[model samples]
Target: MSLGDDTGQTRIRLPEGSDGDPYGGARRGGRSSSRSLVTVVGVVVLLIAAIAFANRGGDDSAAEEGAASADSPKAAATAPSGKKPVTTKAAGIPAGFTHDREGAQSAAANYAVVLGSAEMFTKARRDAILRSIIVPDRVADFEAELDKAYTPEFNKNVGLNEDGTTPKDFTFVSRTSPIGTKVTESSADTATVEVWCSGLLGLAGESSTNPVTSSWFTITIQLEWTSGDWKIVTHSQKDGPSPVPGDERASSADEMAKAVQEYGGFTYAR
Candidate 1:
């Protein structure tokens, strides 16, 4: 008698000597058919039990993982820790940051703001800013590099005078606002931090050739802990993680100039 059907349904064929009637088979043949049926049913039941057991095991593991996560401490990277920000100023910029990863990030952010400001285009203010934030041995190097970068031709290109002054009827708009900061590397005495920033530049006036425009960028500042404060060891900048520009209408030059005057920048160490 065949033990299986090709069409997927389980089938049992009675012995060749048995009659077609269900109860007319010989006693021996009936016993043999009953045993075969019982064996097949037992195998199917075992397979079903195994499948159910495996599913339950997976669920238990998932529940255990969820419980462990619930009992663990919350992530600290994105949350504030209630530490006070730096409260001192040098050369009109924030200074005296704590000697920690957070402090490095704060210093990097504030340095980015000042470095991208209109003041940095002028020699005196630029030197003052560099001296305030840069490490002692590196201050002169930074000044020299910036002096070459902010030459008369560069100043005129950004709609400023040859001497880095705003024209009489036009207001030069150069500002940098740091969006966030991250510490990429840190040690007991030195750290490297990246500051993501938004900036405004150009001249704001009705007849100005270069109207104020916004751009996004990131600044990397390597800092050293010195005299209980963070100072810049090296600094560099790169263009953004910028987002798509919005569809909002551009403000008039008068509105832009007035808003800049009314809204003074903040100390970003916090």
Candidate 2:
């Protein structure tokens, strides 16, 4: 976890976007087979991978983009870069943001992914993420606040061990998907961008008390142009661009588990 780690400008054409119960039956159906259920499970897993988890979910209030700021920045066409960018990670989170507005939005989206990650519940990885992505002076404060929020009780509610480990035979999945990013305000030294996100959180093992479920949220990041890069100064989330629950039959626990294993997680850069 020593210092060092690090994305390219990915154009999403402005579009987007796991969690589970093991043996228990609820809205997630019976142990019995249903094609619709399996399809739903499969689709959610793949969507997380494809829809851009970097802009993953947040609190319900995040769905509200607030009144448009009078000073908001214009939406500039994302400059086409001939340079293929290489990704770097510091302490596992993407590092070294660029000096432009696209770079700032990219950093915000990637930061949202890491922030909504399961690692954020653990002290070491959380520290690493904060240290790598946050403005230097704010790291300690953010760490302290997160430590409080990710308390042991919270871990239990989310089906993690006291230390945030997934129980044996279970894979814990918590991911944020960024639908898109818009720059509301920007300057040479400061910027604010809204990342529309969707997230999944829960345990993906048999008989898990807390099953994975999806949430819709938004993350607004205030970034500073520091050390030749955009670093997060502060960020907050609110809930939902949530859609009405579909009438489609829900997936069974087994189907959800199988899908989690068959698919792999993604490394979001834009």
Candidate 1 deviates by what RMSD?
22.0
The clash count of every prediction, one per candidate, is: 0, 29
User: Distance (Å) between predicted and true CA of 182, model 2?
Assistant: 1.0
Tell me the lDDT of model 2 at 152. 88
lDDT of 2 by residue, 138-219 (tens): 9999988988999889898889998887789887888888877778899988999988888888888678888888889989
TM-score of each: 0.71, 0.67
lDDT of 1 by residue, 1-270 (tens): 334467876655544554676644556658776787897787678768998887785778778668876425334342444667678898888988877877788788788888888889888899999999999999999888888999999999999889999999888999999887777788999999888899999899999999999999999899999888899999888999899999999999999999988999877653
In candidate 1, clashing pairs total: 0
Ten-residue region with minimum lDDT total, candidate 1: 71-80
Q: Which pairs clash (backbone N, Cα, C closer than 3 Å) in model 1? A: none
